[model samples]
Target: MIDLSSCLSESAIQISDRTSCSKNSNVSCMISPNSTPSTQNTVTCLYRTILSTRKKILITVTWSKNSLSQGLSITIGEDPSISFKVNTNPRLFRKLKGSKSLEFQGCKVEVFWDFSSARYRSVHEPEPDDGYYIFITFDSELGMFLGDKARETLQKQEKSGPRMAKFSLITRHEHFSGNSHYQTRAKFCETGAAHDILIRRSGELEGRKNSELSVSIDKKTVIRVRSLQWNFRGNQTIFLDGLLVDLMWNVHDWFCNPDSGHGVFMFRTRSGRDSRLWMEEKILHKDEKEEFSLMIFAACKNM
Candidate 1:
């Protein structure tokens, strides 16, 4: 079991009347699998519900002199996270502004980036990950800011690969603990060819849960399948044992299966065009050796 009861140990300003987890039993959270907030919110309602001793966040709420909007409440923690209680949205949110503070939940919360932590990859490439980050709460109800990268990356692919050949991974759900079910031979974390940056959006997806392993290789050329690309629509599932799972991540996944290794899965691409699936691995579900057959275009091309 991944334990993460220590990340939020330090508190800048303490909330005196805060309820204790030793007494209550409802506010428990853990560090996600990737150990970064960007991976996944491992701390879920179920985690709280299952814990013997519920964990609760102790916070300070001081109303500031200058207030912008009455409806929004930003909770700033000295740990670089500023939680918000905007009257608009309620899913989960954080933004990309430099160090600053924001008001939330009827109190003035300070904002700053926590650079003490180790360096990790940022899902939104192009955006430099030179330093650490601060957590900010946003109105998920109003709109979202985290998803812009995925959309932008999708648009830049044509300049990266050949036509009717390349496509990108879009994460819809990101949670760990389901892939192991289907992949009895292997665990779920080793499903696709994505970086750890994904944990933030999908919470450390375990078993291809979120089809959002989005990529940004935008050169119009050939992309070897270094990873398994999971199709989100229906039963179009890819597996190691499920399909050419070993072929893609063989450099890493080969430790387990040596003899039956997959060659490579390549795709062609052009920007703003549909992507096709190309397979070169000897061990595959079917055969597509021919040039035209090697090109698997999208079912619906973008007009």
Candidate 2:
């Protein structure tokens, strides 16, 4: 079932998964509040007639500022490919850092966010449903919103830390598809002089594509990872809120595989961010296709 009024309305609807069905999406519409739905009505009438005849209406959304421009064309299928761009509102960033704040350096860090990707078993015709895949790239080069306390911790370690092998403590959050969407967008916070964190990814790109999707919904994700690395004897002040605070930690890497049973890393994070922090690597070699799997795991610690 589809209701054009919900998403098209002035505010958000109670719907959980807006674009859940592909065929059920019948009305290809572009309802801009600033613009009129004049010519669109004719197209809608014919679409309804087609739906009545064919019993399926695969709708697409396209619009433009000029003559019903189709600059933004998004198809809706079982796994639709959507692409669009807009001038995003900067209120949130301004809210967190104050109106005049611009840079992210030396702020308080309370929590650590992460953006990581793990491949899942690909879907095959014989099996049809092996496992779906998803990729999360944190928007920030550093971690998410961590206030003053986080800034203080990382600076001390960046200056005079031991020269042992570099180990790391990584903080991972739950999959962003759930309620995590309501959390916070990704941003780099370097409140301390030197914290052992690296940016393998930074949130999503300009486009969003899924490998195997049962639904036609388009998803956007934001993530953060708190990682501690070792061996840095320099100016290590955490950077955030357009200021610099002191915080740094030495994170280590502990690996595991099917050959070896498993390894446990110290846990650090809140209940929401702590879930599924580690995904152990699994190796399977039987048929023409050799496969690998990763387990998600995370730990929380007080610095």
Candidate 3:
């Protein structure tokens, strides 16, 4: 029974003009209003901690999928700048499963995966639900691991037991069609329950100045904005799982330029610092560590 009354205030919200785009790409993909609905590419990254050379190391596993093929990439480093990278080539058949070894800061790390029989909810999903495994071994001890068949896979590969995963899933990025309602499952916090997030825009009147935007979680309406024309960009705070969550949206393009418009929404926890700073950035800032930021893109089809 959490209430979102504080988010309706006119003076508290801040609006900005930032948009979400590929982190590793220079070309911005724009959607046209007259374009048809097509598959969208997405990337999900998991960050974890492992022991290397008796010291802690951060490892990132990124699963990416697109229309052509799907594959995974692994990066090991003490920080973002000093990292070693390896990935599976989607265009080749050998990507189903393989192993790679590399040295980072003088520490030897070996990565392995077996996705030949991985089960996925759909072809578009990059991560599988079961029937597969991914392992990262530092020196000779299993440090980071994934998949439901971890133990079995380890036994087959003759690897030792793995230390508990210190790596946490901090962020996720996705691209989806904006023409229809967009939905996804997310856990607001590390110990929070997974909720179904639904976002959609109501049709606009021919001469009306604005449209309606609705956001719901677990099938229950949480926030509704009327006269979206004036309030298309704003931020609000709500209570979820006894925690304060800061919600922000920028749908100006969605309604203002339908032919090639897209919108960005961010859900973050209020850290007693300044919510306005996060509201202005609107997207995930690499330096923010305590907050979990989930970034999603809803773009209209382009002609």
- C-alpha local distance difference test of each model: 0.22, 0.19, 0.60
Badly placed stretches (over 4 Å) of model 1 are 1-98, 114-124, 135-235, 239-303
Residue lDDT tens for model 2, 97-135: 111111212322121211112111221001111121111
Q: Best lDDT goes to which candidate?
A: 3
Candidate 3 Cα misplacement greater than 4 A, ranges: 1-40, 46-58, 78-95, 151-160, 204-210, 255-261, 270-290
Give per-residue CA lDDT, model 3, range 134-252, as digits (tens): 78777676677888787676577564445444555555666675354666777777677887777766656334455777776665555677998777776656666545566677776
Local error of candidate 3 at 296, Å?
0.6
Error of 1 at 198 (Å): 14
Which portions of model 2 miss their true places by more than 4 Å? Answer: 1-165, 169-171, 175-183, 186-303
Cα distance off (Å), candidate 3, residue 14: 13
Local error of candidate 2 at 222, Å?
Answer: 12
Global Cα lDDT for candidate 2: 0.19
Compared with the true structure, model 1 gives a TM-score of 0.19
Backbone clash total for model 3 is: 8
The sequence of per-residue lDDT tens digits that candidate 1 reaches over residues 193-297 is 331111111212234343232211111111112223242211111222122111111111222222432111112111212132223332123222211111111
Q: Could you tell me the lDDT of residue 281 within candidate 1?
A: 30
Error of 3 at 73 (Å): 2.4
Residue 110 C-alpha lDDT in model 1: 39
